[model samples]
Target: MFRLVGSSVQLDIQDPKPEFHDLFWVINRENNVVQYDNKRKNMMYYSDYGGRVEFNEETYSLTLKNLQKTDSGLYEVRASGDEVRVVAEYRLSVLDPEEAPVLTHQLSRDTCNITLTCRGHDLSINSSCYKETCEEKEVTSPGGVILSLSVSGSTIICNHSNPVSWKTDVLEMKELERLCADEGEGEDKVN
Candidate 1:
């Protein structure tokens, strides 16, 4: 059984046996009364029993939310009957939010081609660049890398192996059209 002490608590339960269905229940530690039913797969709001919960089967776990100060004590579970019983005790504690990763991209243009580069913050080495039909390539270092594609319409992708980060960018045909127009204008001026 997993003890949840504060808000936004979620539980992931895995069942081992295909035949028997897993069951869970919560008991109020202070009052010694059943508060939740895991078999029904339901959720309870802010109640007296915050983290006091248990699972009936070893294969499954339970998650409780909106934990309060009163929610502290022992939790028990019965897998089969009087033969198998699992017990766990927990104390509720509050926590703060977590941070997310940031992504950035850079594009450079020259007369012949254009290069698009993608970089991730504090990532691992072994990164690679690829096109739609090609396989993954390893990037030598963790820093930014460039992916070169024709000025024509094509898709390019950059991937990192260790931290598992990837970015995709497309080369627009408009760049080729502009290049051709500039060449035509230059030829006309020379004529």
Candidate 2:
């Protein structure tokens, strides 16, 4: 499961047999997250999960809040009776939201060269635009963030995205066209 930072996630027991299992324990790898004692109707949150964890008595589910990047790990649910048995397992990944991509353009003659840089991902896309159309490229960063540059009419669109979130930036090219047009007119008048 992929989640954004500061978000919340609920881990529920899959195919729960409420009658067979009364004691439920949620574990994040080797660390104990929370445990519910159905017989005594008591819930305990261990380690640093005191107020960040919530346990539902009826569904034997655990909800974690205010997630951080360090919380990405494998989680397991163990139900104990005569012997401890694993009921559900989950691999969680927490990522910070993507920032808007930076779109920069340089105009010369009839073509406008553009570069799109994704913040934090260290990925960039360089393309050329002619008149109202632009070249498009899609690049994937080393950390799995995706950077894309596309053209919509006279607007250049740059998008930065990951599994958890996405952001975009736009550059309008109408001014570039006007500048180039004026430069062309000035050359004609001088000739």
Candidate 3:
């Protein structure tokens, strides 16, 4: 059983026995079995039931998006014919996007390193970082992904992706310089 929390629900099934060529089936609550198109390799939906709905055979998953309350019901999936029947109940609850992520910068003058950190409400899962000119990197940390860019350009773009969506933050080198200069000035005053 899979819990789909988003607007679309995905169902994946695995068949190790390899008894059936087609691995899954979707049935509505009215006892009508959803038809699958072997040529298109997707589930076919009629205008009576609603236009054509599709599913991926390779992944053994079906995605139903823009779901309405009427879409909520019991969906049955049969794998390998009668081998296994997976019943799933869907309850759709919409939620607003949480707070925007807070982007922070860390600069090391001695090392010429600039790291941009994006902190969000949820960070338990891994996050990824991408640069416009550079390759993307993934980091596993409690504070999310830290994008390390050379402090030479005026602007650096960093993208963070979680399970839900991707968020981008643009950092300017001038801001890092100002922050480093401010810290240095504070230290000099103490000395």
Candidate 4:
């Protein structure tokens, strides 16, 4: 996936030092020409939908600003040196920040079990822990979901994320032991 909306993404050419050729064009997935700098300094051929395009001749990198879902797709940059060649290729994707997951603890006298949940706009998943460590998380969105369990000095961190963003909830064993007296639910959200 690519950067989020309103962010800029730069697809750079592999070469450290690039030659400033007279004819260069960057095309998007739909065959829509995004940019063109013909021997001039920072000029683009805005034919179809220009949106927000920036072409850097010095580095031969194309930066698309104020990104949107429509901008997600394959991108190809063709430059003319000895002959016309596609120097760079990219598949970009953009999505909004997912909603933060919820973590609740079920403390029964002497046991601590943490529940982790992800509530995104279009996705929801649940996982739980029964011991000092958590089990391998199983999520619905296989391509975009990442669930990890890490043990800190005195806490266990349950992190949930997608391609564009992530959120975490911590379960401190010592802290829970202290707060369990209340016999109520507790939640910790990470931004």
Candidate 5:
């Protein structure tokens, strides 16, 4: 629904009565609709996110297809003839999905040491740990990303999030144990 950034969005007001005199669509903070609606007078405009903006003349509704980050803003329907009155108000929010971080490497050696590097959304985090335990793990927090787990568990979960959207990835230490088990066969393996 409204949780996606490149998704289509609709702002509709039932019984908008746009046929009324001095009634028009107001975008952001302006009376001009050309910036939003490209088909007003024919030809084309920016289309926001390589899409189209449609204004239903019959229903008095505004629809922006293939929305983008710039489309997040306020919209209003008002009548400015005799007495100025704002009939309907709507707010559109477009949010991008949280980028997933990759747990790249787990090197097995003495002390059960491991090294991991995660890169996503113009951010990179490098972390190292011993025994692969949550308590012993050392991770660096990157932009809009969080790494959390419990000391008593062998599962390491890394989460990338924002106020509106988030994504998570889990690494099971049990599966990784086989990779680091060649040498030091029983040295504090992830059990």
Candidate 6:
């Protein structure tokens, strides 16, 4: 699961058996986060997780608050008893919110050809529009950020997104037509 920094997430242990004894939430199989003692009917939050972690006694679930990038890792729930058993595990990734996409356009008077560029994060996409038709392109980066452009009627939309956040910019096709119309008026003067 992907989360934005400073956000909170709930880690649920599905189908928890009542027969299990003590439950431990460990990070990356090394760092002990929280321990729930079924016999004692209490929970212990370790290290910096104190006050920022909540344990549900009834559901045997965990809720972590104020997530940070360093908190991204594999989390496991283990039942400690005569025979240690792994109950559930989850992979969490914390990422920063994506910025709004930038849109730029170029038009030629001769052919009235238009090219619109949308850029966000490390990716960029270009869309070409002529008359009432537009062509779209999309791109993705290794970090999971996506940039895309699409057309709906007279509106062109550029979107930039990650798992946690999304930003978009829109342009009206009529505005482009008006600009091209004005450029056509100056064509004879330039020649």
The TM-scores, one per candidate, come to 0.28, 0.85, 0.37, 0.66, 0.58, 0.92
What would the per-residue lDDT of candidate 3 be over residues 92-162, giving only the tens digit for each residue?
33333344455565555543344555554554222222222322243444423323222235665444443
Clashes of 6: 0
Q: How well is each residue in 123-178 modelled by candidate 4, as lDDT tens digits? A: 54555655445554445465576655555767766666777777877767666545
Which 10 consecutive positions of candidate 6 have the poorest summed lDDT?
13-22
- Stretches > 4 Å off in candidate 2: 18-28, 109-121
75-181, model 2: which lDDT tens digit per residue?
88888777777888899899999987787766665334433333335788777766666778898977789999877777777889999999988877776577567
**Model 2 pairs in collision:** none
On a 0 to 100 scale, what is the lDDT of residue 81 in model 2?
74
Where model 4 places Cα greater than 4 Å from the true spot, the runs are 15-30, 35-42, 47-51, 80-83, 107-140, 179-191
lDDT agreement of model 3 with the native: 0.47
Q: Judging by lDDT, tell me the better candidate of 4 and 6.
A: 6
State which candidate, 2 or 4, has the greater lDDT. 2
Q: Which residue pairs show backbone clashes in model 4? A: none
Sorted on TM-score, highest at the top, how do the candidates line up? 6, 2, 4, 5, 3, 1
Worst 10 residues of 1 by lDDT: 125-134
Query: For every model in order, what is the number of clashing pairs?
Result: 5, 0, 0, 0, 0, 0
Better of 1 and 4 by lDDT: 4
Q: Indicate the TM-score of model 5.
A: 0.58
Model 1 scores a C-alpha lDDT of: 0.37
For residue 82, model 1's alpha carbon misses the true position, in angstroms, by 14
> Candidate 4 overall Cα lDDT vs. reference?
0.61
Quote model 2's TM-score. 0.85
The number of the candidate with the highest TM-score is 6
Better of 3 and 4 by lDDT: 4
